[model samples]
Target: MDRRKFIRNTAATSSLLTLGGLSLNSCDSPRNKHITILHTNDVHSHVDAFPNDHADFPGLGGLARRAGLVHSIRQENPNTLLFDAGDIFQGTPYFNFYGGELEFKLMSMLNYDATTIGNHDFDNGIDGLLAQMPYAKFNFLSANYDFSNTVLDGLTKPYKIYEKDGIKVGVYGLGIQLDGLVTKQLYKETVFINPFEVAIDMETKLKEVEKCDLVICLSHLGYEYNLEQKPDDLKLAKKTKHTDLIIGGHTHTFLDKPTVVTNGAGRDILVNQVGCFGVNLGRIDFYFNNETTVADGYTIKV
Candidate 1:
């Protein structure tokens, strides 16, 4: 199948797509490998669904409903991974009451593999953020945030590698600059490195040295920005090579489908972000065989 056509068709429709004319279930053969990536972003402590009378996401988006959706998807495909793009902190009164403990605990229950950091996460201060770390089961990844002088020094990893069904996946993280978005006293002493440079170095190491079959960047850098000088997911995709997908957050952009951007190497890179408040879930499926790799993605309403 033509790669461009496949992406177009998948983006146009939410129906299940076949891989090389075979259904996803049939791709379980030893010669073929299927991987499913489930993601959410900027949930912002929405543990409960909106009221039925609410104007926007009425009766939609609760942690329980999201969990059920994730559970069912996991049941369908064992070779699956869940991720978030940050801003899991601040939004509702929950954060005010618990100071992010509930958010971390519930996300841990949902089995999030990893996530980046958002500026709003510092609302409770760096030390406050660190205090709730004991409740989280997943690791935080941030390559550009130099936390050597802070309590988060050894807590967050620069990147992580995962292997599933013979496919090696390398995931890194990039966060937006927190200088103006977050107060200095909140994120004290955390140095912000250049994300573009960090991305190139990380992708090089992951693709050339680590030899990962798939490279992903869990980003809180927003989807796009009007200013060319500002770094965003679209710019990051066009600037780097080897990163297969960029799951983004911070802008709360609701994309029904993944935006396929041609990377510096001229390869297709999927950049996707579901809307905030747990109203949507992003799903991407990758099929790999001896000769080629194909991908399909769409958003699921929670």
Candidate 2:
């Protein structure tokens, strides 16, 4: 089958939007550089697809299928990066039996560039997580979760930068508070700093010091909460200035398209989340030139 047929067969839906006041056709310009970002969130150790008779997502979602889809996309665009927003462990028997080893190994095979830490990721305790690190080829980034006094101290970084086709892409991670949701013993000595505060510091450094062209936040915070005191992805988008996109998880919220939010600097910020269990893959294509950037985003069913 052709690339279009392959994508249409695998993807459930798609959306198109022009950000930074640029036309979609502008992407055809030879001078414009293109980068594709493929992301997943809250996969929760679902290595296999659900049975056809199962309710909800019958015959959907398997790591093998996701890998095939990712391979095809990568073939179409070599300047592509794959990311996970976390909750990579503790849902199915795979995690129960292997304790996250299989998840890391498979994701490595898929060539995931990076991922963040999630609350459930500590279900086997910080030590268990540390033990599985060697299996993961990608880096783990979490700006707010300080591991200074813990076993994970130097294993994770606050942020990372990647240059795709000469375009600097700075990526940072933010995890939700583990105070009430996670037991103290599991995440011992892992300090949870305020996400909003960390966002300010990270974004400023990425844009100014690093001079990155695109800034993305891999957030494990829930999409939204009813409580005003709760910090979520939506709150993070509006409170920050330089962050260009927020890929979120922890709430298992499914969105067919990215939600465009106005940032503090009155710029457009994209926020997206694909529901849990590897059901869908979130894709965002960015076209960049010396002067401006334009993006189109959507979710593909896996």
Candidate 3:
């Protein structure tokens, strides 16, 4: 394929790269409306492309490649949203070398809509996250993490809303219990709240107050823990009423498709997670009608 055609095709695959707001063949007709939600989690600062002969991933994932995908998706669809589920620091040499400055800068460049906080995000302590805050242009959504006494106070919001082509979207975040996972000194003064309660409040507000068409939770509480004990995405989705989808992280789950669960009102709650790094980009395409609402998601390996 020619360079132009190859670039166009590449954008059609990656979540972060798109032409404008849409992807190729994204809109079947003028009335056939579509919105795309592109997401990543546990990226771990893999700034540069992987080595050519790496065991698992070779020259597969990178910020630049992801950006090209985002650009192409946008060009094909008018309504598109891009996000990260967290753990934006550590893993690759970028975090060890630049201390998350590069990751934040790259996300900002790719125009990430929002992101959540993960346990590894505290690897450099609360100060490390705070230091790189200035470089990030997107909002940090964390409803379950109370930063009252920490340096992160006021740096995060419970949730935010986005409207694309009149499709109202409410997005919030849920963090895991950092007690045993992270050091007290690292996440100093950061209070961990009940994830269920936060979800209740956020969904109520989003559904009742914000009047959003769809509600999404960026969860770092893993995908599904030992059934009822852990606060995984499945449990969160069950308790949630207004939440329509949950983009999850922290467990490094590799899901080919989103799992659908019923909420308190018996409404479908879609939950998804794309392994880790830039290896795969999670893409959820929603098709909503005034009569009924619908959405679906799957992974696109990059």
Overall lDDT per candidate, in order of appearance: 0.86, 0.87, 0.81
Cα lDDT tens digits, model 2, 94-170, are 99999999999999999999999999999999999999999999999999999999999899999999988877889
In candidate 2, which residue pairs clash?
none
Q: Residues 235-257, candidate 1, lDDT per residue (tens digit)?
A: 99999888888999999999988
RMSD of 2: 6.5
Choose the strongest candidate by lDDT.
2
Q: Model 3's lDDT to the true fold?
A: 0.81
Sort all candidates by TM-score, best to worst. Answer: 1, 2, 3
Ranking of predictions according to lDDT: 2, 1, 3
Answer with 1 or 3, whichever has the higher lDDT: 1
Each model's TM-score?
Answer: 0.91, 0.90, 0.88
- Give the local distance difference test score of model 1: 0.86
